[model samples]
Target chain A: MCAELIFYSVVPSEEPGERAEIETFLLRNGLSYDEGIEIFVVGREGRKLVACGGLEQNIVKCVATDPLYRGEHLSLTIVDKVIHLAYERGHSHLFLYTRPNNIAFFAGCGFYPIVEVPGLVTLLENSPIGIRRYCDGLSKSRQPGARIGAAVLNANPFTRGHRYLIEKAAESCDWLHVFVVAEDASLFPYCDRFQLMKSGIEGIARVTLHPGSQYMISRATFSCYFFKEKNVAGDCFTAVDLLVFRQWIAPALGITHRFVGTEPFCRTTGKYNEDMKYWLQADLSAAKPVTVVEIPRIESHDRAISASEVRRLLGTNDFDRIAELVPQTTYDLLSSKYRMKAVGSHTSATA
Target chain B: MKIIKDAMAGTLESSDVLVKVSPSDGPLEVVVKSEVERQFGEQIRRVVADTLARLTINEGVVIVEDKGALDCTIRARLQAAVLRGGAVEGLDWSILQ
Candidate 1:
């Protein structure tokens, strides 16, 4: 009755040949395919894979359409299929990320733009109220100004480097927002990390610390990725995670500068910071709302301080050395005989 | 055009509507659940009734779960639901217009 396109849902990893075909398509189109998410494929009876899309939690990603099927609106169909599946699974809130040119297409498909990191990625949600709610909650206590600085920190255990970075940003801005990554995917649970950070910044009144929501989650901090391979496509999570900051988070809070500590130890984190710097400075001819500021690593001896360093020292029973790495509050918590080994660190490792 | 079976159209996405239709022995019945009920309740009913009349379906129950959709969207969804539920033959495309 309709076009001859046959739509099929396939297990991303179970079918080797199909998986390889999807990878080939993504690789050819300058996209990366992340396994473990639900994949939907469309093609004719000839077994020619023409388009692919996937659903991860409530967000849609990894969409690609073959050049031969350019006018068939395959991306839209795959998105609709995924969205319908999410709805069938009882998920009412849906979101997706696409390049700037496809934003209008998804918008026409009942999704509205929530944030845009122009020329990179655009985040859209199925409902307008979802983003409007975040904006409302953000503006309730945020002071309006161009000098307000923002920092998103996982602070696995809150270290001296974290304090130093916060101090630098706080010194420059009248208001500083510290969003502690709240995903319970690390050596410390989100509750423990939040508590440690709260005690760590007890005296810094202007530097208000907030809990990072799902949108700012790093793959290292999301438990779902603890089993999945990381960075299958190097910059997958970078574009999606930061889109929230660039579009909705920073703007509603009137944050003009985003501060990140330079990385000298972990390559993953270092790459994330580098990409964050580029995203903050990208399309500068348009003068985006927030500019990224990279502060040199807070060092101890000859090495830069990091949460991974502290975690590595935890298993060695060297409390003294670990003490040197973190702030007093983090040290107190780490030394209380309550400790756990951290999983491997992944940067921009968000889904 | 009477509904002979069950059918659904549209979705729960915002600015959209999920319409379900079922054959009934009673007169035309349409119920609406909308996010903007206070603002669009009457309008939604009016548009639904007009759409049912246009489609020539005089005996069926239509359930509309709206997420702030406009009149045109409601009409479109109702049309799809009616066509899918029954109306397999003697369909007049001009009347729907």
Candidate 2:
């Protein structure tokens, strides 16, 4: 017997009842509902929710179909509707996180596997040649050297500590490729942060600056919601991210060493550094392991200089303090942009 | 006609095809994924080429995901996608012949 299905788009923030129903449905299917999901497309056979799919930004997550309606193609319908919704919202590219066993199912939906963290989760993208195209682009900037090194940095405002790390890394290797995190989730916008890094490293001879892509430290690849254990989430996130770097990205650029700064603050970043060693250097069987080099963070006023310190000073309009933390280029830009706001607020306070 | 923006048409339902077109700096590139590719892969490519030729779409990346779609379904979906991708000028209906 064929079962007729109906689909409905539910925004969890707006539809509380439907959100609860979807949460229960996902749990019943052995999938946890990610709180970060922006929207969900649920398929119902009359009053019973039989299938569901979600979109968290450009990543599709928590897709499940009832065992009773396995061959009904309800999963495809839910995914199709979710894709349409994402496209309408200006998301041309999409990613999916699924278990290894379900790779064939999602592949049938046009998603090609990008990377897999064995027995944990697998990352897939809608475009079959997405990573290939990205690697091809990276190949254009490939440099030939035996001790080629790489570093990925957020560089929110290009602090002095960041310059110290890059300079130290560049001095050790024949060539150093520095990638500024492309996601604009920080206080400083991506373009401005990239410009600050470029200006700060103007005369660094052997270092090349490149923009990061979705394959690198991006929201789509760094999500920790797929793991059931909260403790392992951080490790899985680091493994997935560094695996993409070690597999597709490092080989494309001929990088043999990965450099990072000693994290004196932020426990998450510190753990990520520890996991980076295991994922990139310790795993001997996966791919050619890349050496990990950790440089001590440069200190200012007896404390480790950090971008968070600069941002905090920027909040209080303490230009003098911020000046000591960041490079001259970043300090100048911050003063020029925030000085005007500081004056405006001062005038209003007096009035 | 040129693809000025990214556009998509059709659905992933059974016996249907989903066509996605996006602007590209390179030459015309077409990628087709079908369940029956071993049996009718060349036929599907020919239909896509013929449809793009009719629409005068000589550039952009065209991706088609097929699930046992007929030849005519592929053609119609490609035309709709090309049009939606900003190939509106000089769209002579006679090309349908």
Residue-wise lDDT of candidate 1 within A1-351, one digit each (tens)? 545778777677678788788889877877767665665554443567777776666566677787777653566566666666665555545666666788766654557676664465566766544566656677776975559999988887788888888888888988999888865667677888888878877677588888777567543212232123343344544655665677677777888899988877667667777777765667642435578888998778888888877777876757889888887778877777455543343333211
**Per-residue accuracy of model 2 over B1-97 as CA lDDT, tens digit each:** 8998988889889899999898987788889999899999999999999989987788888899998899999988888888888658666888765
Give lDDT tens digits, candidate 2, residues A267-300. 7678878888998987543678999999999898
What TM-score does chain A reach in every model? 0.74, 0.93
DockQ: which candidate is best? 2
Winner by TM-score: 2
How do all models score by TM-score?
0.65, 0.93
Candidate 1 - chain A - TM: 0.74
On a 0 to 100 scale, what is the lDDT of residue A97 in model 2? 86
- Quality class of the docking in candidate 1, CAPRI style: incorrect
Runs of candidate 1 with Cα error greater than 4 angstroms are A1-8, A17-32, A36-52, A64-77, A87-93, A117-121, A144-146, A183-185, A217-247, A271-278, A281-292, A332-351, B1-97
DockQ of each: 0.05, 0.75
